[model samples]
Target: MTRRSIGIVLNGVTGRMGYRQHLVRSLLAIREAGGLPTRDGTLWPEPVLVGRSEAKLAEIAARHGLTEWSTDLGAALARPDVSIYFDSQVTSGREKAIRQAIEAGKHIYTEKPLAETAVAATELAELAAAAGLKTGVVQDKLFLPGLRKLKRLIDGGFFGRILSVRGEFGYWVFEGDWQPAQRPSWNYRAADGGGIVMDMLPHWNYLLEELFGGVRSVQCTMATHIDTRVDEQGESYAATADDAAYAVFELAGGAVAQINSSWCVRVYRDELVEFQVDGTEGSAVAGLRHCRVQHRSMTPKPVWNPDLPNSVPFRTQWAEVPDNDEFDNGFKAQWEAFLRHVAEDGPYHWDFASGARGVRLAELALQSAREGRRLEVPRLEVPR
Candidate 1:
């Protein structure tokens, strides 16, 4: 069998998500598994770590037993061997590098919120399409086991005319006074393209569209509950970005979706992120890895008593959905699909155009919050 090496220039490897999820979990894991096997050959991923810091890139390369590491992004993009250019960089820093990579005739793949604005994101998509390059964006949540099960249920007529969806996401990020903040300090700064809406609305946009329907309009309110927070350097700075976002979306098929994303709220649910879907026949609540359901036949009818303590155990009424098949890591699953797309020219639905739509949702939601009115989400047109 022929063995082919597909070189990938991976930028933003120094950041947390870039290092842990994209590099270590996905790419390195693929490399460790002897790469992806095709009909004619094995497509081995040869990754060149690209970042701004020479020392960090070198350290990561050495730690992973990798040979190629570079601090010069332009030089890395110019390499003929590197056919795929992957970016998981900061939101504000993505557009320029992605434009450069597209100009260099490389297929593009990157994390979402493709750019800080919808205009920039659409421009990148147009550039890639004009260059005739295969491009993909990260929609990893669609591959989660719980979401997979939810999709199965929907397909099986379990919901029976789905009605609405509710999503609760986020955890309290430490203020960095006593404990260091879990998220990067840049996440709370508006100047750095940071906000809960920008960070999460992309996920919700694609998710709602994939599950229910396209978002038609949105009404939202955002808040910066914690106005000041300590940074990585132990210096306090004003938090200009919204720490919390409450959004209500009207879907195309008359389905309503309400999503609350916040970094200041404490967790009281089964997972860090959970989505509840209600329908005419049944309801299901899905966490990151688990799903629970309550059918109409099994649902309880409890009398409301204002004078007496409630005796109904509403949480215990739901039954857990059994795992019928083995599940892979969501990020890893997408990575494998992207690799196959690169190797065999396979069909990938989550392209730059899809990402541009997500950016449109985020932009609309932010505008709605600022204007105090419902804003319509117009469809993005990119050359296919």
Candidate 2:
């Protein structure tokens, strides 16, 4: 067994996602699983943790029994062993770091919202392409168990002809004055590239495009429900970014999707986020871990009446999709996929250009909100 070791410079390990998902769950898990399988042998990822805080980085490294980590990104990138650069940093810092990675000739993988805007994201894609580097963006939702099952049904013609989709995603992020905020304070600051639109529309774009069709237009409205929140330092600050966004998207072939995302709404649903897709032959509601379906034949018919008491076992009508297969962590799956792509030239469709498109969708949705009208989405291209 020829096991090859390649270093991945993981920037932003001090952050929430980079630490938990990318570093621990994905890379370390792969190491525990005997590395990523390859035709030749296995490709092992050696992580070079990079972050601003030396103390925090050191702690993470020590906790995981890892030794190679540094506060300096340049030095990390300069290492000959490092071939892949992964970013999960603040939105503002993403473009510059990615550009530097590209210049360093590293294969790149990064968290979504590839850049603040479509232009920057497209530019990064172009730069990566010019350097002939393999690149991937984290499209984690498509790897989720529920979404995977949903995709399966769609592919198997269970839905017949997909018609429309409705999505609800949010939870009441506690105002830090009463309780410590679950999310960081920067999430509510626009200048720092924080907002529901920038954070979530990218997710919606990829999900819709991959499952149903490409989004063709959008109508959106956004709001800042809580203007003030206490920061981690116990200082109060105004929330300049929109915490809530309601948007309706027009997808290719005239499919419609309406999605609401917020950090200020109370949760009264089955999951933190849920998507309901209705088609000609059937309908399905999918959450993070579960999917339930109601075919046309099994769908209940309710008679509308203002004066009569309605007693329909609506919730019990849909059948729960069984766990036909064991699901791996989504982050780990994507990481393994990216590593395989880099090492063996395997197929990976989610490139930097796709990330750029996700950013473009967010941009247009924000514009649509500002204009108070629906706007057409133009096809974005990254120059070869």
Q: What TM-score against the true fold does each predicted structure earn?
A: 0.98, 0.99
| Candidate 2 stretches greater than 4 Å from native | none
What are the Cα lDDT values of the candidates?
0.92, 0.94
302: Cα error in model 1, Å? 2.0
RMSD, candidate 1, Å: 1.0
lDDT, candidate 1, 260-321, per-residue tens: 99999999998998999999999999988999999999999999889999999999999999
Worst 10 residues of 1 by lDDT: 375-384
| Alpha carbon deviation, residue 61, candidate 1 (Å) | 0.6
| RMSD values, in order shown | 1.0, 0.8
